[model samples]
Target chain A: MKAVQLKDIRKSYGQNPEVLKGINAAIEPGEFFVLVGPSGCGKSTMLRIIAGLEEVSEGELIIGSETANRLRPNERDLSMVFQNYALFPHLTVEQNIMFGLHVKKIAKSEQIKRCKEAAEMLGISDYLMRKPKELSGGQRQRVALARAIVTHAPICLMDEPLSNLDAKLRARMRSEIRQIQRKLGITMIYVTHDQTEAMTMADRMMILNHGEVQQVGKPLDIYNNPQNTFVASFIGSPPMNLTAAHVNKGKLQIANKWNIKVDGYQDGEVIIGVRPEAILPANEGLPAADVKVANVEVLGTETLVSFELEGNKQWIAKWPGQWSAEIGEILQVSVDHNKIELFDAVTGERLEKTHSKKVLEVVL
Target chain B: MSLPQAQQETQSFVKQRWLGNSRRFASLLEGLLYLLPSILLFTVFLFYPLMKTLYLSFFYSDAQGVPLSFAGFDHFVQLFSSSSFMTSMKATLLFVLYTVPPGIILALALALLANEKLRGIGFFRTIFSSTMGMSVAASSVIWMFMYNPAIGIANRFLTWAGLSEIQWLLDPGWALISVSIATIWMNTGFTFMILLGGLQNIDSQLYESAKIAGVSRFYSLRKITLPMLSPTLFFVITVSMINAFQTFGQIDILTKGGPMETTNVIVYAIYKDAFINYNVGSASAQAVLLFFGILIVTLIQFKLGERKVHYQ
Candidate 1:
């Protein structure tokens, strides 16, 4: 296993605006690092740069204590699984798996041995003689994985390899891939736009938006302690609810309707973030506000209730049991003070926590 | 009432069956209507002439190509024993061998070169495929001059190198070879264009993955590009072979089956027998033999080559 280090990586095409602007990351050896973002966020570009398929305009790429910026893709000593599962159509499954082995001129018997082992590990041994087109999408994905595995490269790069499969197959392959990566101890740099995959599979994940890293940490750490409003809104399902508010002299005013006592902070405009699951039905112990429901989605085991704050900003609260809340009906919701996250309104940076621990009193 | 009800049901069942049959017949008629133009053209131009040739091959024919008397396979027996006919067969086989492999290989090489992602490659592609636009008669005329001993560029180059100039077209030993060279050049443009198209259609990601596997360029070409291009290569080989066997235009323009019949390929020989010598029976026999020979060769090619072709 090899550790990959990137210092200030930047990329651009000709005179166009930069695609990746000054990315800095150090991936530990044998770490399952995931790069997650929405489309056009440059995550795939970063992975390609590490694979040596693309050049870094300005950066220092160190792979296992050696600089790799000038190395050819083949010389990088890494294997990659493309998004489309780029298997050679003319070759059978066995040949595709042994392509790298053949290129390295390995012994004939050893090549067969490795190929068979990978095929069996992937549970695709029966498909050795079948062409890629004859297999289903999920089977082809296994073949692509087997091809990468037989090489035994220290690091493996995957560019959204599971995006092509159906949802059920994708779910199955997700765990399968994770198991293989762990068993082989290959340092994996995976790129995906799916947040669920990152949250579940990554030992450490980096969140990117518009060519900049928002946050990088363990999935739960980043999820619970998002650094900025972007990270807060992007990391969770239905995302966090962010709305404009004002703070003055230890008092918080939201939509000019509810005021809550918040001690030990300067008075200024702030954006408050709350996870959907943190919002609950109003109770006596918590600060509560009366609001009209805008939408209600019953998901059998749980329900999602959405209400509009000031300026028509939609905020969703995930409730534990099915709720038959009718849209346009008045309902009362409460938010725990400790669960609320505050960011600077203009800069969107998270504000520091207050030292005082007084219960907040809301006057509606 | 029961009898009338049963009778009425039977009448409706019979009507439904008749309707289904008429619908099928209508569709068959519509299909035939769609095929009418091509069928008429083929019968008038291809089928009728083919049948007439088969008939004439078994009889002695007059100068006007009217049958005189039943010869009872005399023309076939005579062709098998004739030394000139044997020479024509030998020349045709030699011409096919010289032209098909060289033509396909040259076109493929050019295709591989032009497939590179280089700047200003469009100009080279245009130049390479420009020969496809020229008519056979025109290109053959140009080659005729180039093969001229005194004024030809070929002889000029040989003489410039201090080597003695040999006749290109007039020499009996060189006639077939000269014609083969010109044919390869003329046929290359179409073949190159097709192979290049096939090359372009390959998914570029395949090469990227191969590169990541650390395969050399030549190995990738052999293992990846060649197998992927097998279908197109098979097509080009079959077409080129058929074309080589039936070559007539360049021979008529350049060699005229002259210089002791070194370039007397089957089609040209048949043309001379029928038109110049007015030996219609012999020409018909040769034409029939050429048709069957081409058919058997094509069948053999399909049997041997298709198993290796990767269709996808």
Candidate 2:
């Protein structure tokens, strides 16, 4: 059921620098896998490598049991949707959708049938005769998707296909894309720099940084149990708050926050990661930390209160939408002992418990 | 006190109005200053001569250097009867038919080659367009040597390649065609530069989309590239056609209207009728007819181009 497998794929442009270094992953059939990274992380380059648009510098790209390292993009039997949509401006919607089939010399009747089905699925059936320029941005994107879908390729590669859309439309299209992938049951590898898009749309998302895989997991798993500080800081809105602290005699001390129990680490300084929502108004049986509320962002259903502890380290505290706080108010923030992540600050490695299964080792 | 304050306000308002009108006058004067030299030159050279040509085209000037009578369209009528004029008209039409297609084809070919993503493309592009720097007279002289009957490089190459010695510029049947071939070679680079610029402006993602849709490069070239490039093609055609009609420089230098006058195109015939024959009236009529021909060709090209240009 391996739809696509890239084994130790390493790519470098001449000798300037390594772009994608030693990437290895196997995408399951019908899986909607996403590659999420910042700019210059070479996520799009890896997708292009899979599409055979770029040659693999080393290692292998296996799509459906065939090695495609030396194959041309047209021969790879994969369809790609670019960030710009890349719709043929001269061709009508029907022609653009049927372009691949026409090239392969498929039967005209079959081509028509497939084109009609794709258009109907994307709700663009009436726009068959319209040129790409005449269509709206979202319609043009749907045409690009229809073009890829009509090819009936087992794998579809999307490189920030929704990046050009407005915020409202991008959110809508994110779900629409996931729905399309699931309905077709095709293996889709989507690339994006937007972590929200990755977190929402991916069946299993891979977080990459500096041309390396940071974490690959279900969205919630990475959120709750990031393997390292990088993933904790990378995966969430406003990111995680990492405080330089120490675990002495199994007690976590984060500058004035005291009597906190850490399970394993003994006597070394480590970075403590706590998500915005993890911190709360200190209650019974919890350690008290002196926190100064710096700023507050108001959402309709939730108000995010940003606070700073000792050493000027900031953390977010999410409360109910009705909650309000003064700008310079002093607050006591606390966290559940198990939700706290301890890491070696210098090495950036997780220092907490490690398990064989369900282990969250998100690294960047 | 109130009356004095109102007077003072009115005085300031009057000053503001005066300032506005003066600014307008200054702007008008500035515009007139910019256009003065060109306007004076046009009045002295172009408009004055055009008026004189208009007047003389209606007169009959006899060999005695006297205006014998005001003949209305008599010269035009006589030009229709003249066999050389008819031959020159036919040659001009034939020249247009010969040069237009080949010029367009050569330009398109060179543009496509220069559009390739390769190193040193700028150098190649400059070399292609540099032919525009060479005057038609210069190119014609060079090609005359190239078509020399005995020792010409073209003929010598053909002889060396084991082909028969084909009379190039000397044969009456091949004379006009030979001139057109040289004209196409010299001017195609101009069109090539224009079309190359057009091709570069086309969004490359369109081609990429076509390729991903499984469209072959040839089909994309035909369907997308050609339609997108039609505007540039139309421009080149219009310009090259005008160049074709005004093609006296080459014929004057190379053919001298020889080989049974097969190379006697319209403008060259105009030169002969005006300067050689000293019949400026008839030459002006021919010039007017050539102008109408060029105008018609250009209008038709634009009319056809409108339907093909994808404005996007």
Candidate 3:
């Protein structure tokens, strides 16, 4: 296993703006590190730079203990699984798995042994004689995984390897990949645009937006304490609800209706973030107001109710169990005082909470 | 009342069946109408000549190319026994061997080079494929001048290299090889363009994956590039072989089946017999044989070669 460190990594095309502007992260050895972002956010470009497929405009890439900026992709002693599987369409699964071994001139017996082991690990042993076109999408993904693992490279890079699979298959492959990474103990740098993949599969995840790192930490840590509004809104399923508000003299005002005392925040316009699950019905938490429901979606075991706040901001609350309310009907809702997050409205940076002193009141 | 009603229904059902049949026939006629133009052209140009050649091969013909009497496979038997015909077959086979493999290999090499993503690559691509735009007659004339024994660039280069300048197109031993060289040069352009297209169609991620696996350039070319390019290579080989077998222009322009008939390929031999010597029966026989030879060769290629072609 090898640790990879990127210091001030920057990339740009000729006379164009930088796609990755000064990204820095140290991926520990044997860790499942994922670079998650939206499309065109330079996540794939960063992966390619680390794979040496793209030139780094400015950075120091240290693989293991050596500076590897000048190394060719082949000399990097790594394996990469492309998004399209990249299997030799002419070669059978067995040959595809053995290709790297053949290139490295391993012994024939050893190559076969490694190939068989990888095939069995990926549950693709039955397809060893079949070409990639003959395999289904999920099976082809397995073959690509087998090809990468059979090489026994210390580092493996994957570029959205599960994006092409269906939902159920993607979920299955997610755990399968995590298990394989654990079993092989290889340093994995996986790039994905799906926040759920990064949240579930990564040992440590880095959330990026607009070519800059928003936050990097353990999944749960980043979820509990997002560094900025982008990370907050991006990490959750329904996403954190962000609405315009203001704080004057350490008291928060929402739509000029509710005022909650959130200590240590200065008097300025702010955005408050609350997870969909954090909002409760009026009887369960501190009652804020009875707002007219904009929409209600009963999802059998749960419900998602949307309420239109001031400035036409739609705030959705995920409630446990089925709860139905007519559109435009008044529904009493409340906010969890400790769950509210504060961020600067202009810069979107999270305001640090100094002390736990929350007092809620409705100014209506 | 019941009997009259039943009869009326039966009459209407019969009319409906007739209408359905006529509709089917009308559709068949419409399909035939759409295919009439191509069918007429093929019958006049391809099918009729083919049948006529096969028919004339079994008869003796007059100088006006009219059949006189049934020869009953005597021409085929004579051709099989004739040493000059045997030499023509050998020359044609040798020409195919000389042209197809080397021509394809050279084109493949040039295509691989041109497939690289570099600045000004379009210029090189245009230069490499320029020969394809030149007409065969024109290129063959150029080769005719170049193969001139006394004043041609070929002999001058030989003399400059301190080697003796021998007759190129006039020499019986060197005539076929000289023509094969010219044919390869003229055919490379088409082959290169096709192979380059095939090379471009390959997904570049495969190479990047190979690169990460620490494969050398030659290893990747052997394992990835060759297998991916097999389909195009097979096509080029088949076409170049057929073209080499049917080569006539350069031989007509430069060698003219002269210098002991060493460069007399089957097609040129057939032309000479039919038009020059007016031996229509034997020329038709030769033409028929050439057709079957090409057919069998192509069938064999499809049988064996297609099994290895990797179509992705």
The model with the greatest TM-score is 3
Off by over 4 Å in 2: A243-263, A266-269, A282-287, A308-315, A354-364, B1-71, B118-123, B133-138
User: Per-residue lDDT for B52-88 in model 2, tens only?
Assistant: 6666667776543245578789878988899989999
Clashing pairs in 3: none
TM-score of chain B of 1: 0.96
Per-candidate DockQ vs. reference: 0.62, 0.46, 0.70
Off by over 4 Å in 3: A102-105, A245-263, A267-269, A289-295, A310-313, A327-330, A353-356, A359-363, B1-37, B62-64
Using DockQ as the measure, which candidate wins? 3
TM-score of 2: 0.85
Residue B143 in candidate 1 has what lDDT? Answer: 96
Rank all candidate structures by their lDDT, best first, as comma-separated numbers: 1, 3, 2
Cα-based TM-score, every candidate: 0.89, 0.85, 0.90
Docking verdict class for candidate 1: medium
Model 1: pairs clashing at backbone N, Cα or C within 3 Å: none
Best first by TM-score, ranked: 3, 1, 2
Which prediction has more favorable lDDT, 2 or 3?
Answer: 3
TM-score of chain B of each: 0.96, 0.85, 0.94
lDDT of predicted model 2 = 0.83
